[model samples]
Target: MKRDVTITNPVLQGVFPDPSWMWHNNEAWLVTSSFGQVPGLPIHTSRDLSHWQRRCSAIDEEMARRLFLKYIRTDNHGIFAPTIREFGDAIIIVSTVMEVMVDKALADGADPDEINRLRAANGNFALVSRDDGLTWEGPHWIKGAVGNDPDFFIDADGTTWWTASRPSSSPRWPFQSDIWMRKLDTERWRLEGPERIIWHGAVEGATWAESPHIFLKDGTYYLLAAEAGTERRHAQSVARSDSLNACYYENNSRNPILTHRTLGEGFPVQNVGHSDMLRDDNGDWWGVCLGSRVVEGYSFMGREPFVFPIVWEDGWPVFTPGDALLRRRIIRGQENTRHGYQLGDIASQEGKNETDRDRHIEQINPNDYLMLPTQPQWIWTRVDDFDYEVLFNPTLMHEARIQQNRDVFASITTDSDSSSVVACISNKGTVQEIGRTALHHDEWYSVRLVGRSVRFAQVPAPNCIPNTEHPLLVGKGAAAVESVAAGGWPVINGGLDIPDSSFAYADAAFLSTESAGGYIGCLAGVR
Candidate 1:
């Protein structure tokens, strides 16, 4: 037996939500939702539970184009929660491509006639990987497997059952849901047999009962689910039954086995739920779930994946150990420490220089980049700063072009299509362009942007497009654009030092996940 080691809560960081865990060949494999990010469905492998390395995305370029290209128009609109499991020699994944109805339409009192017409592309599907998730095949639409967070339960007798969250036929309230199950025909890739509604939720009037997983212990079937709407009241609960297809009774004594809602607002961690349980080689119970780290009433990194220890007591699972709530740190038996990977903490750590080995940086080249098999570094967001480090004061430099005066281009910009090449800043969901400029089109030019101002220059090139005359460099009125960054938002400053108020100036915090308001943080990628 190995001793327990105290490890950080989120083993995988930066917007990795709804993690599905499985142990294969002594290695831990996990997958998370990408939610419309190209080359979606990221797969991560870890030998030591503490350190995880991204292997690849399950949905490749071909799959993305064929399945999600046209459908994925907005953030959090693509891949929902996914469940990965080992069946025989192959590994299988069951998930939903959530093109579900948007809430805004309902709020605006859109015609009900267009509701189903708009939700035609929403459903559950499965993918298989014979070579250990390196590659995948067939979305093999699981017809009739409706709803979100589809999970697989492989019985001892080789029966594979599928369960998912769906709107209850007998709805007691709006957004009320139920967990249902049916036999999955792996060969035919569809659901067969009578559908059984297993559990509603632990709370009396809980809404959005989702992310259900089943476990068989002794002769009792345990059904674990996430309920309470996945917001401030998000929580995990369990139910049990004697027969596989029988009615499951909620663990009335200890229904919500895990949650941090009781901790109130501004706790270190909040929105904890959507857990998946797995037994280790040492025969100990462990679980993985999604949680958001709150800072000043905002979550910038979105919901990240967290791993914790669980214990079985009186036929129900207990989360953490001494404390029944989510913890910033927890202890777990250390096993399989072969893979030595650690996430760098440049943003939090002190005394780390630009060239310091502790500094974390990633650079992406767009020309050679392929949308399929997207490298783990490529994530969805407004701007992702990889190797480009902007600790307190930052500077951004890049080459850009504008086809027309109506089209604006500079070293960096919130929107390249905006008419003016000006200094701009966004605060509280409002964009203000401070500086304005005009430049020649179909030409190559160098651009540099700092916290207070921006600079541009026209450089002649041979093989590249024609050249043009651009406005000279200058500075801004404010000596330095003061900035405060929480999480990974870069604080850029110091391109060409000149006093000019025309360039855009902004506080780096204005570009944080708090301001963006979505499931993903700011991502640095060429689009």
Candidate 2:
């Protein structure tokens, strides 16, 4: 008897979100929301655009420098969902952005009441880069609202159009979304296109419409929108328009074409449809979407990118439902290797830290993973996608040492700093500050762990950060296990269920304030 194995599609894995794509000349250029992770748009350029190989990130430190003062505030904008296009000789993309800072209300007004109220809002907006998207101009004003999971389309007649979800638009209208529209203008930096209310939940509860894209095929303008919220499951709905000027109505079915139950077999993804569709050289349809990885059977991170294949049926689109639990190989043996990447072993250790350009560390996850600056892009917290004002750099971090517990190691690391500094907090939340040390460059660095003993030195590339503390040449030493367990951090509930025991795994990242003014990357190497 011959046995057969079913294969899944997204050959590559991670928490990918808000899929966006562009077909340039003969190459397929695409962008995705990297989320709190540094580096905007995990752009993969493909000759075929089907089988993709990561090339370079569209947004990075250097690019940030060229455009930092132009679009949105650097510290607060962790490049949200962006839209890209080819204008004349160059390619461009704009980001819906938010930056953090002390409340303007506080500065402008004498009233403490009004000032405190304004501080709580996380402002969302649109930013554009005229210099081929490498350097942007401004997040200007596209109306103040929670505009995310946005995208744009170029009309054949040369008019540029836009779409995004006003996720909170339903508070008053029940099932309504501000499917915004605008024209692309070169003379002016921001969207000069006259904006309008293209669509609202005219059908069912468009409760949360996301990633709305407009495409033309066979003289029909097909508008595909992801309906339902991000968790549970997401479905795509389609609407058609005979003219760009005419109002496009929702497809009567008004339901999701795909569901988590269909895609998430046993362990399929919960929600799956803030998608951007792209066509490969071969003409096959593909989409990039946002979903969570749900480690430990619980949702932790906000949303990530999910790539899948798309099929068209009589003017509508369809996607393959995934399994609840992920199957090892999305596609087996077909994983042809170009440049191989390795995720090495990690361990919990108490160590001294040092960094310089030459002294760098690797991330435990895929080396390609990068951390953004602490001011904005790399927002972190006890909250998801937190703003910049509240998110500070962790040039220094604190932690108390408990029993040599296998389950409590956190993967942590800093950007490739010419010099690095980090420390620990004791059981009493007492802070220990480690001064600046030269960072190792070229390859990623890591902590050398041997049980309670820890040393930080330059390892090759690709690894996570260590969380234990090491005393300076002279000072208070690491506390006892009982002291650590008492109050440092509540006894981590599942402190014994990690998949790896041999090597301690680390992923907690807190950046340093030193990299604030200049152009330095605060990268995260996720395993």
Candidate 3:
């Protein structure tokens, strides 16, 4: 038999957290939480679990409008983790609307009881789709599920069951909770039977027993959950019982079935947990979870989706057997599988700045731009910088081109009378002003730097739709300079002293690791 080789970890990348997966018609469909980000609850489809593509957003415009009108604002307040399921011909998604007060409010003496009361008003709601997730209807309130991270389990007898992490009646700590379950009367949209506490984590002092997903395997009911919160100590634990209503559950002998908590700061991947499990077409068990990619203990990409294999031993699920730390790579049935879109591919197609040299580019487009949630490639100077919001709206397009051992060009348009400078900064605290533009409200402009010459131009808006147009110049530069150094440090009062234009000659060496002096490389954008 020919073996199939596949890499099965990190099935999806970049800020896709709290993953929930369901296998349907030989295809795997996955959904993740989109906290405070409109077009929320992103859905992805995969065939072999290694390669995936975003299909459509479950939270539609009408849903977003309703949420905005009811919740007041979006920012850690909208949708939490979502559980996706296919029952007969209907697809159901259960997600929590988190409207709790911010931590700053609590620190500033906000009453916990009042915060809880406001949060209680926000509960789990279900959206049903009859056409294989193309269209959805009815966010019917699941009144019984009082907390976040709600998941659904349809029993073998065709009875619908609901399980969620219910907040503790009395205060202990944030996310100190227990798993609860109750049978649902789908017609009435209410709990049919008595609600019961399922499991309160295997570890004695585990604070959060959340993201509970129940699965039935070989006549056993298994409950898998994430514990120790979503930080460095995040982990996956499993418990098995003979019956759904079993008064007690037996914790897996090899508890914390999956985790990277012990990997320390050296590992590139950390905070591994908040998982959901599924069996593939090959009958091999696999898991999808969230983990962060960190560089020297700093992670800006947020939690991402990763997949791992599960092996059963002694009637228990064992994750990545004999290894406590999750590896960056894993081998599956070898069909010669490749996963994820390469940076080169995304740059070539989405960037519109194609060149022969190895270059990575980020273009500002309406589809990919949002006000509340920051884009992935952007690294802001401060948390409160809302400049991109003003620029991205009204469908203004911008492009940044970074060619290795070459020059960097950035083109931006603004609808505000704000003056901003885009520059190339080195790791050794050196700043080279690439382009500067005086952007008036509702104007289009281009900034270019080649060799030692720098020019700024007010151009016509490119006659192209967002995400489809190539970077093209519309007009000539009004101000041209033979030597950029004559600009006198370009916004010297703003920050970083460049002194002279000699720095532009050394553009090739600007972003090198030796010059940057860090585990990560250099960054270029609006500052």
Candidate 4:
């Protein structure tokens, strides 16, 4: 008799992006891109990758002390994508921290070489140690240029090696780049051999590939790299070699192992690539990567993590459309979640009272919240980095729009003082901060969205349009108004409403809707 089953995604929900993993002893350590613009990268751990909890970050104050003494940079300079590997009794990490690119360079133009050099100058690379994988140290460079998409592995003989996109020292031109590798002495953490270029691709129209994660399985070394481009045209490919340091080439058995279309239309966005693969403690395989987001019509460079479940088929890994969420638990556990929905009481009740909570909660309930087919990255925030968590239901919205009749649903929670709950609305990329009368206890808040044209009953609506000259003067200094694309924001009922100071509205599931643009917008802060 035949049997049937279902798969679930986002093994680690909420902002756990660009994931890579390694097993040390009996425990599994997972690392991901800590695009410090929002929150630091979180290292998740699990006896089985299915049930992951964040352990810590690849960068912290103590880590800074161990790597570079008195090292300081805004959240932008610390760390970007990080990968982990265990060598014998020692565990090491390879990281890249690309300084945040500003709008000016993106505005007039950007020379890829200029961008690369500037990004590297502000970048830091290193491998650190921790008796407990919770914290890391060592800013030691591996005798090469600062590279992106770094992943490492070890042979049975305890030989440590590193492979990264554009791993060698050279200015990257259109598509004239390659993935490079080097053998390193485990003790000193330095490169040994002359770096070798393992593979290369086109550099003109759609340029070089990146984010290579290699794993040795079943006598065949499988190499997975981000190919195509990282825009609406992201893709992934697989290659193999008999030896790790030897010549490895694309399998050619299949052109693209995966593509943005293969994943299906999810979350009304595009641009998905840059992945890292890993094996769970239970011997299951997974891949995590980043994706660009489209909301309404505008685009955002979101660092989303996608998990791809792996199974060997005819000597290659194959995945189902559902198993292709960019992120999916290899297996599900029967462990009952103790965290229940406490914010449900006020969900439908529209009032002046503010709702807040730090943990993620779905609108309505688990039954009403539809988890998207594509797995989504999840993160837990403290009062410091992100202070609020929110949920909203567009289905519940009932309002009139100036142009169109559309409502966006999502949930929100925040950590703020007991005096007020900050609420806001984004009009043409400009955010108006308003406040509500009530503040949630334990730093949590909730908002039930009734309609796109609707406003919170307590706080009145503000003019939706922005003022003249893009002059949004903050404090005493005059700052140019950061323009948000009006063409991309989802069309909704008109006018701006500041019911409360700030609130967050997120899709309950990965790829919540086919909104034809960015998924949602949120905010959390102390008032």
Candidate 5:
């Protein structure tokens, strides 16, 4: 028998979270949470789960401004989990525009008028696109749907069911929540009929039971939900019942079908939850979920989308069968390709040189650049030895920062007069500048890395900054490292671990989750 080939995990990288998967038109489609990122509700398509490409953002500028950006208040406060489904002649998406709490806003002395406006704008809503998401219609605020992570389920008899999670109407404990359902009046664009609690949770004292998705198979209703919040203790559990509106019982044998909470903080993939499932053309079950790659307790990259193989036994789903923990790689075969999938060598191809890699880069039209929102979408290259000249257009004056993970390795502020470089590190939430240097205006400069030391020079002439004799900053100071470790987080002693040890950088470890101090990852891009 031929062995399956190994492929990288987190198929969709760089902070794509709350992934919802569905099979439509014989292809795999996905939508993930956008938080504060604009041009929100990104839709991705994959012929085979192994290789995926972005189609277009389902939420456009007009919709984004009207529904989310107008009232956005915090970094992780907008655009929560979105569920995409093919309904009738159009594709519909159900999501929530989360806003600051009214009490908190009032306490902060926010204008009552604005606070009321924000409150009116917040809540769960729906959008439909008939032209493959090129155009959209109706943010039709679902009148009765209350809570986050709402999902749409169309029953066999053509009845539409809306499922969501919210704090219990009458709470017995703190953070107690329940999953409930109601008949969705699709034509009227609102939820109709009486609401009923379907499942409390899989376990006692489970908190924040949200991200509810209902799956029906063989005269049974399987309700999947995420509980314990989306943190180190995040998890996904299942409950089942014969009827849609009746109470469901937990799958006690395997309550939490998936989670990384039991693996401890040392494990690489942490905080795994908010999962969605689908079956491929080959009838094989697969799943996608949000997880983070934690390096020494710091997860700077934030929650990313990871794919896993799933199997059903006794009417329940098993994620990554036989594996207790999420792996960095998985074994797959080419035989599992979808209907129109042309198998590629992506799984086994040798690494390409940068020049060879550039050929595959998608070229975006210059006009389309205007439509691009100011999100931290980045292109990264990791290396121990790099020599490149960066031309900072004097007229633009855009401030760009260089990072070695969460640490601010250096920053360049350019203006018409001249540019200055500041080498810095972040301690707790405070930024401390370690050194500074000045460069001639409109001059081409080269930055090179030799081991842990970063050197700067004027191009062609090789004149170093200040005078021609000194390197910019050597990795000599341990004060930054000491301060960071003392700040009460696990510190990776040696440098950042490059999975491929072909390169090494000692201070790369400083760029981590603890140092970043936000829900999002350390970003490197021009704003």
Candidate 6:
């Protein structure tokens, strides 16, 4: 098979993490964890693995709210990693709804019983779609797999299997876990046979041996999983057995088949684990995993999707060129080739009079105002979809000239006095609020910022200084000079009040990379 000379590293950008893929009807369909964001489980489709387009969300807000009410206002509490597979004519998505105990819940006086109840609520679910993934039916709850990152597999003989990470009965550490597998009774939508602890971590006392996925090749069962937690040390491990119900499985000689953890903070892609593999139409093995692009030891965009080629050696799948920093351009096998334009062509195009005329025309406008469009370049905190209209752009970088001009402006209106539109800049790493102001409700307002000065106006009226003594611009360093803004409820008295309704109109020219500090620059949008 031939390979493309270069492929982009992150096939899908932004906070799409814990990727799962399934090939159906001669095309690839992928899904990722939403983590309490509404419209849970976004699905994307691609003919070639290199290019992808979002098809539709597998679960919507109404469905998600009905299924996981405990996730409301909870950070990192909702749809964990999902595994997509084709069982006969139906496509099945097995996933977990995680509502784990956290410091915030403890600080708010949550008892052990309440935490246990939340844990009990966290279980695996199966959603089936028949019409080539256009619509889904029945998030039919699966009882036995009581853990996070569930993987569903169907054997060649038509027997269904389910696997997940469960709290270790004899744990070595506080939250030690092991991967378990069981036969699924599809007719009843539950596990039928006894649960078996198939494989643990590569090391005896390894932690977080989760994200289990099972595959069969040439009569050998390949069980793949992620272990060592999802931080700088995150990695993917594998095990294999001759029989599906083998008493013990053999760990791969090369245990951590894929990871960039040891490459250090200098490598752009960090936290590389939680992967899923697929065989392309051309019979070539390919895999997709989650990795974060860090800058100066900070990653603001969260975990993004990365793709790599896989090769089988000695009956075991090896991530080709095992230990190296994932590059921005990846090369893969392909057939057809189209090499047309080069740098010189781009220079010639730029020299054209029409190009200069177009540039001059756009400059005459001076300001570029944009409303929330159908497909905007916005990366949400966790959830993919939002209820209100929000214009978000998260691609600003230090090299990008967002601070060419000193003046920034915004027009906004709110439904409640407590609700306010905020415009400010801060570092992505700390998300520190630099230049910002709260707008009054029920009136059209405009926010203007010129250097260190910030002003607000109720349209028709002259701009006035804010009555509140709180400084909108408070941070230090480059973050202090750069500006990004969000319009919603302000943090009042140390906590935020969720408003009923709020709206903000923005101009992108004023939102700069300098204001939005952090590793991946600042995210400018409305909350």
Backbone clash count for every predicted candidate, in the order shown: 15, 76, 5, 59, 2, 20
Model 1 lDDT tens row, 1-527: 47545556577766678888888787778899877665577888775576777777888767664454334445546788999899799988888876633455456565454343334425577889998877788777786677889999898888999999988888998778989999999898778999888888986788889999988998888888999765679899888887888756556568788888887775556788999987766666678999875444444446788877777778778876555655445445535432111122333432122124332222222322323122232222222111121111111222231100101122233235653333334444354555545443433233323332234333333232211221112111222212323222223333335443333433343333444544554332222
Off by over 4 Å in 1: 1-6, 100-122, 334-411, 414-421, 425-430, 434-518
Worst 10 residues of 2 by lDDT: 482-491
Ranking by lDDT: 5, 1, 3, 6, 4, 2
Off by over 4 Å in 6: 1-6, 100-122, 173-175, 322-325, 335-524
Query: Each prediction's TM-score against the native?
Result: 0.71, 0.57, 0.67, 0.58, 0.74, 0.66
Local distance difference test, each candidate: 0.59, 0.42, 0.57, 0.44, 0.61, 0.55
Give RMSD (Å) of candidate 3 vs. truth: 11.8
Scored by lDDT, model 3 comes in at 0.57
For model 2 the TM-score comes to: 0.57
lDDT of 5: 0.61
In terms of lDDT, which candidate is stronger, 1 or 6? 1
Q: Mark the 10 consecutive residues where model 3 has the least summed lDDT.
A: 381-390
lDDT of 5 by residue, 1-527 (tens): 22345545677765677889789887789998776555577888987666688788877667765564444565556788999888877798999888745675467566676445445435777889999878888677777677788999998898998899889988777899978889989887677889888877777788999999988888888888999887889998887878888855556578788998987776556889998888867676777888875545656456788877777778788776665455545656545543222223232222222113221112222222212232333322222111111222222324333343333443444333434543444544357655445655545333333223333343332222222111121111121121111111222223323232121123433444455444554433222
Candidate 3 local lDDT, 40-84, one digit each (tens) = 777898877667877877776677544342332323356787899
Q: For this target, which candidate reaches the highest TM-score against the unseen true structure?
A: 5
Q: How far does residue 255 in candidate 6 sit from its true spot (Å)?
A: 1.5
**What does candidate 2's lDDT look like per residue over 325-441, in tens digits?**
222123212223221111111111111110111322221222443444533322122112111011012332321121011122222244354454232212122333332344333
| lDDT value for model 2 | 0.42
Q: Which pairs, if any, clash in model 5?
A: 406-511, 407-511
Question: lDDT tens string, model 4, 406-488?
Answer: 12222222224455444444343343444344543322223323222222222222222112211111001111111222211
Q: Using lDDT as the measure, which candidate wins?
A: 5
Clashing pairs in 3: 4-333, 4-334, 4-335, 5-334, 5-335
